[model samples]
Target: MPNYIETDYKTDPAFFRSYIKPDLWEDSNALYKEYMSWENNKFFVQVIKQFDKPLLRQIKNIWNYMGIRPKEWRCNFFRVLPGGNLPLHKDTMSKISVVIPLTNMTGELYFEDGTEVLYHNMTIINTQVPHGVKPPTEERIVFHMGIHDTYFEEVKIGHNS
Candidate 1:
């Protein structure tokens, strides 16, 4: 199976960009400190969880439209600064992640098998495989949701089901 699959679900990137501010982003390593070391924290990505109810509702509606149910609480905005990169590694928490590029997304999502994907729309990524972001030319923001209960195969085949 492919490491990632593009989805038909699309959204206005500007809508998501309106919610982002440099000060609002928090280091992801702070929340996952147990999994990373201080030395490696510099390359860790940032995240924001200040989305309003309306935005959350919209995301849930998108999930419903795609026929997938992701953990609502796990959905948030992920940011990677120009010089920062998320190292290639397998996820220990979730098997599947729904990623939607929101703003200044110049990075490439690459996998261990040498496949790379650019964020042009909504995509389902297999977090169980070794994958990470290539350092972007500018700050990149993506709406990410960790789907623990669903497998990638189920999502890849059930888009309209």
Candidate 2:
């Protein structure tokens, strides 16, 4: 056992609740004061190191579970609330995003061609795969881990990206 298990949306629960103990990512935002200063143009980014230790442990767990050792990476968090939506977009980075949902989300994920992915236990999210979020919820918080494109699970080759 792994903490994250894969399953199709139709068979998963749509509504549920899970409490995520804070890893104090606030510091990674460069303290609360600094975050408030630039909360407009940017939400918060490039500050993943502020909370690196625990996050690294988590990354190791996910990597081991995926059976891949990443060479380079970046990781962060997305604190989205109800009604918060991410517009459809594509990532140009050479790295992939690994997301571990910290809370329950009722929002649906819209793929490039408009497919719905409303499932949970999201351990990995391929940035190359165009996607977006719709109808967010306050309870939806996700831990995002970035992995170099050089490393990835072979099983997810046909599924993720």
Best lDDT goes to which candidate? Answer: 1
Q: State each model's C-alpha RMSD to the native.
A: 3.2, 7.7
Expressed as tens digits, the lDDT of each residue in 1-161 for candidate 2 is: 12122423221122111222354434323423331333322222323555446445655666665656777776656665565456565565534566655567677767676667665765455556667677665545665666666433342422442
- Model 2: weakest 10-residue lDDT segment is 9-18
TM-score list, all predictions: 0.79, 0.62
For model 1, residues 8-58, the per-residue Cα lDDT tens digits are: 776888777776675666677766555445533334343555668878887
Tell me how candidate 1 scores on lDDT: 0.73
Q: With candidate 1 superimposed using the best TM-score fit, by how many Å does residue 39's alpha carbon deviate from the native? A: 3.7
Specify the poorest-scoring 10-residue window by lDDT in model 1.
37-46
**Candidate 2 stretches greater than 4 Å from native:** 1-46, 51-54, 151-161
Residue pairs in clash, model 1: none
* 46 Cα displacement, candidate 1 (Å): 5.6
Clashes of each: 0, 4
Q: Which stretches of candidate 1 lie over 4 Å from their true place?
A: 32-52, 71-73, 156-161
* lDDT at residue 118 of model 2 (Cα atoms): 66
